[model samples]
Target chain A: MTDATLTRPAFRRGVPPQLIGLGALVAFFLTVELLIQIGVINRFIVPPPSDVIGSFGRVIVEEDVFGRFLLTLSECLIAGVLLTVVGVGGGVLMHRYRLLQQACETWVAAMASAPIVLMYPLFLVIFGRSMWTMIMMGFVAALPPVILKTLEGLSGTRKVLVNVGRSFNLTPSQQFWKILFPAALPTIFVGIRLGLIFALINIVGVEFLINFGGLGQLINELAERYDLPGTYAAICFVILVSILFFMTLEKIERWLRPFD
Target chain B: MLTPANPTTQAAADDAILVVDNIVVRFETPEGPIVAVDDVSLKVKPGEFLSVIGPSGCGKSTLFNVVGGLLSDHQGTVNVAGETISGPHQSIGMVFQEESTFPWRTVTDNVAFPLELTGMPKAQRIERARHFIALVGLDGFENRYPGELSGGMRQRVSLARTLASEPKILLMDEPFAALDEQTRLLLGDKVLQIQQALKQTTLLITHNITEAVQMSDRIVVMTYRPGKVKRIVDIDLPRPRTSEIVGSEAFGRYVAQIWADLREEASRGMRDEEKHTLEHHKGGAS
Candidate 1:
């Protein structure tokens, strides 16, 4: 404590976290750029960071990357919507029914560890290499964690809180919406973030494998033509898509549970 | 219908607002059936603060749950103002031992929850809830969440919530059990002040000797197992009391007397636990 007080007037002072983060990122890219230019690191396998940044405009204009990003974003949003709706609803159902929970909770946990992308061939046959196939793949890959975590969240509500609800004589629906749902929300958000991670990976992976969809297909073509700079640039757009969903999810969570 | 059950032999029944009549609770274990509470009965006069003090595993919580309508599988009836409770009753409110405040809700919102369930208008509920918040001395904390508040402050929020609901009887199961001694005593003083101001009938279940003696008008001591009322000790202290009374000789005497009554039961409870563990070990050996 005394050390902190003594050093209070030194160079150590408050700084915005985002600024420091941006600085670190810039320093990393500059170091890589210098390394590749100095020939200490080969530029064949990995392009210089400057070239990657320089190719961003070309890829966006020539590849119609924004339109493709929007397509991928919409498909992901649909899959995400389905994952939460179906997964949480399924969890709530299982929570309400002990028999169902006992029967299928293990199966859901098992599915979480299984490679869900293995079933893409069947999804391909059914959806015919369209957006539906990718959507279905993302939706399925992301679902298990949401269901398991929803059940976990609902089950984890304090007995005291539920008793308070009951003592007030709340109806079934009111008990759910007022007490159970709100109490379980933080955990449910955790499930959504985890599920979206799996969903986005599978969605982009399928797009790359089939060469017919969004950012992943762009990445595949750029890699095939030895356009390493453009390939990395396209991967940044994929990261952008991820950041978009995560930021929106965080905003919604903050809005819903302000204190937590 | 409940008025007919009032026996003329018991004068307190005529004025009692809450009555627990012959409640019996049993739980079936793998070994056999264990009776938690055996034909326990009590009554609380209107505007009185009554406490039930006992050792752990004495089924004090079982009786508390029965009274609060959280556990209803017991064989008996809990009546509030001549009305029988089939389940969670509107006239009955509970303050629990665990942290009961919702972390997502602000102080005013948590207090306003019961009112919101009753479909009161948003503005009216907020206004009413603020009154109770102020009553519990948490006025400026109306917008703060449970996570933002201290443990004692959060308990105050729950207390305010129960009070806002306007329940005829408040059932508290060791509400201040989690707080430090100083905070507990201070909060206990506040709770007593609020109870007197509202003329609210309260039933408190706790194992703290001084806590039971400090706030209660009367305390019922329960036995270790198959919990039965061992004695009912009336606190003859003056009214409008505060935490200051704890330093007095009379308060210490009351605490000592209740402790004497509870000491044997607490030891018996510990012995029974030891015996059970020993028996389990023997069975494992076999």
Candidate 2:
């Protein structure tokens, strides 16, 4: 029995989804390039990949893109941490008290559907087109997803598992820490993914609206000056951020999901 | 219903280690109170492998929960080691059908969970966890996370974790129901061997007739919803049992007897569910 169970090899051959996504991405870029090369689409409207890459290099050398990139990444990281803590904490509390959950139902519904972009004008007035406004906007925009996901996770906790925990003489604290936390992790990660994507979009959107110092701000400056190649280059950087954020979260989910 | 008030009942007579008297569990629903376990009672002797076999929604799991003190809204009294069960008592351990192994923790940490809850020192908990790990034949995989293990191995870790607590009574709610046939059979024998070695008082809930006959000293057959005990059939087969006994004439007899009792109960359950569906449909239409 042991030998039969153990003999199966890992890394079985198949076309995995990650490879498929990469293929599709490359195909998209190629098509866009073909369109531009054939003069079907104006180069000014959608800059060619070569122009974007060249403009990206110039920005890296002149604008010290690393410094600005670090600032934006730091804002996202800090905001992500804050949103996770607050959202999960609130979810736990609300799960314990159904009344609090009920009270937040309407607000959560409103936040889910409401345009997060509307928050930029108010943030601009308060923080006056600064990094704080960008950070705070990211925090607020990301908070809803985290909260909703966590609540859904907690709500879905198995009754049998909870009873099993109790039967084993686990304290309430132990129950939450051991069973509740792990059981809720997959959904919580999903929430984190959504929150990260939203926060990235909001940070960039707010940067454009308020003229803050980030890739979004750079995109606005390039567009105002009609530097389409530079605009596309900055947009590529934003896309990279989104892809990296999503891939990192996908990695985490795989790490947390049960094996075999 | 096994209510304690019926003093003359043969089922109530015993020098049993655990006695559950007249348990009636109700769930508060939007419509009204729905009774799950209706006045069910039983006696459990020490070092006995008892199986509670019932159809779906027969409240067997609910009974196990009440006995384990995991359910609080029961009308009857349950005593473990002569003390009334108010909440989870330290003397009762549990295993459920679904994997409750924390994916974040390694197998050793998962097994050590109950010990950690009791504030046992880390070294002692690890030691005990390892002991049970070996007991469940999962020695080398201590450092592996629950996610890294197969379904059978994960359930073994859960069993190890429960056994590590060294509770006087172990409550298992269809713990192997999720596994495939081969894994279930293997684990069934493994669990029996371990239980015999340890002389643990086990109350297993399952629907598999053959499994109940193979592992149990006594099998309690329950009726349909608002479940009550239909009968308790005691098996006197010689111990140091093996899978071969499952095909034996005596084991077949036990299976036949239990099936005979279950047939009526199953028909009643189907009728009840049909009635419930009709009412639900009517309410929806209204």
Candidate 3:
């Protein structure tokens, strides 16, 4: 039986679905480039892929976009770290204490639905127009999803696994670390990813809104100067940042849970 | 052929490894308080392989849970080797009906978990885990995760983990129910071989009559809920029984007799479930 399964076609075994997705993305970029080169689209409004590709070096050297890129990266890192610590810690506490979860669950859901980004004016007044404002906005915007997802992950742990732990006379802490934490990890990672996404959005949006530091500010400046290629290049950098984080997260997740 | 023994009249031997004194479990649902196990009592001797067989919803699993110390809100006391079990005891290891192997852990790690809790040195625990893993016939698959294995293989991993704890009593709640008949029979033989070799005291709760007949020294037949022991059928068949015993004439007789004792209770359980569903539909319509 094992040999028969191993003998199946390479397409069934070796090729990952991600390769197909990558192909689709490349096709999309090529189509856009083709339209721009044939004059089917206006170059002023939508710069060709070639122009954006060419601007990568110029954006880094002439515009000195690396410093701004690092600033945005640091903001995202700070917010991501805060989300993991606070969100996961809060989830563990809520799971441990039923009444606390019940008391705050509805409030957390309401907060998630609320237009939190609009509260930037209030945050700006409180923290001033420094990087603190952006960090705070990113943290707040990212918090709800993290907390909610953490709670869900912890709660969704299979009861049988917990029972097995209990049967072994495992201490509460031992059970949490050995069984509960590992079992809930995949879902918890999902929460972290969602939180990172929200954090990135809020961090960039806040930068653009206040015309502050980071990639968002760089994009805003390039757009104001009517440097379309440079603006698109900056936008590409934003996407690059997102892709970097996503790839890092995927690697970490695989390392932590190799079987899954 | 083995005949059913009277549990109430049977003397509780001094060498009994586990003693349950009239355990009663009740659960309070929105409907009201319902009795799950009512005054169920049994004594399991050291090195004994006992099987508890009953109708569906007969609270066989509930009784197993009580003995495993997973259910503490019961009325009676469960003593293991003369010590009262208040919570999960280290000497009592349980295998659940559902897949209980940690998906995150490799086979060796899953087996080593109980030892890890006791703060056993990593090298020693892994060594101990490997012994039990090999005992369950999973010699080469030590580093593989449970997700990568078949259902039967995973259950074997669970069994190995439980056995690695070196528990005085093993409580298996339909550990083979999820597997196919062939796998179940094969696993049953493996469990019997382990029990015979180690002299392990085991109590297996299963609905399969043939499994009880093929594997157990004594089969405890239970009635519908509130579950009460109907009879304790002692297998007088020759020991060191294997999968081959299933074809024996004596095995067929034992299986037939257990079905006879359980048939009425099974129908009664079905009737009650039908009535409940009818009432539920009527309530919704009204």
Across residues A1-260, which tens digit of lDDT does each residue of candidate 3 receive?
79879899765787887887788888998999999889999888999888888888989998778898889989998989999999998888888899999999889879877878899999999989899899999999888888888889889999998898888877789888888888889888998999899889999998988999799999999999999999999988888778888999999999999998
Q: CA lDDT of each candidate? A: 0.90, 0.82, 0.89
User: All candidates' TM-scores?
Assistant: 0.93, 0.87, 0.94
lDDT of 2 by residue, B1-286 (tens): 2222232345334767678888899888887877778887778888878888998889988887788777787798988878888988888888888887877788999899888887899999999899999999998999998878999999999999899889899889888898987788888889999999999999999998888888988788888877887777777688988767887888888888889888888888888889989999999999
DockQ values of all predictions: 0.82, 0.49, 0.84
- How much is A260 displaced in model 3, in angstroms? 1.6
Clashing pairs in 2: A259-B147
Model 1 ranges with Cα > 4 A deviation: A1-12, A30-41, B1-11, B275-286
The per-residue C-alpha lDDT of model 3 at residue B198 equals 93
Q: Write the per-residue lDDT of candidate 2 for residues A1-260, one digit (tens) a residue.
A: 57755765543345677887889888998899999999998987888987887898887887666676777777787777888888788778888889998999679757866787787788888988678888888888788888888989988988767766777776778778778887888888888888888888888888888777778888888899899988888787788777777787777677666442
Which pairs clash in the backbone of model 1?
Answer: none
Using DockQ as the yardstick, the better of models 2 and 3 is 3
For model 1 chain A, where is the 10-residue window of minimal lDDT?
A9-18
Error of 2 at B131 (Å): 1.9
Index of the highest-DockQ prediction: 3
Better of 2 and 3 by lDDT: 3
For each of the candidates, give the backbone clash count: 0, 1, 0
Each candidate's fnat, listed in order, reads 0.97, 0.72, 0.97
**Residues forming the 10-long window of minimal summed lDDT in candidate 1 chain B:** B1-10
CA shift of A78, model 1, Å: 1.7
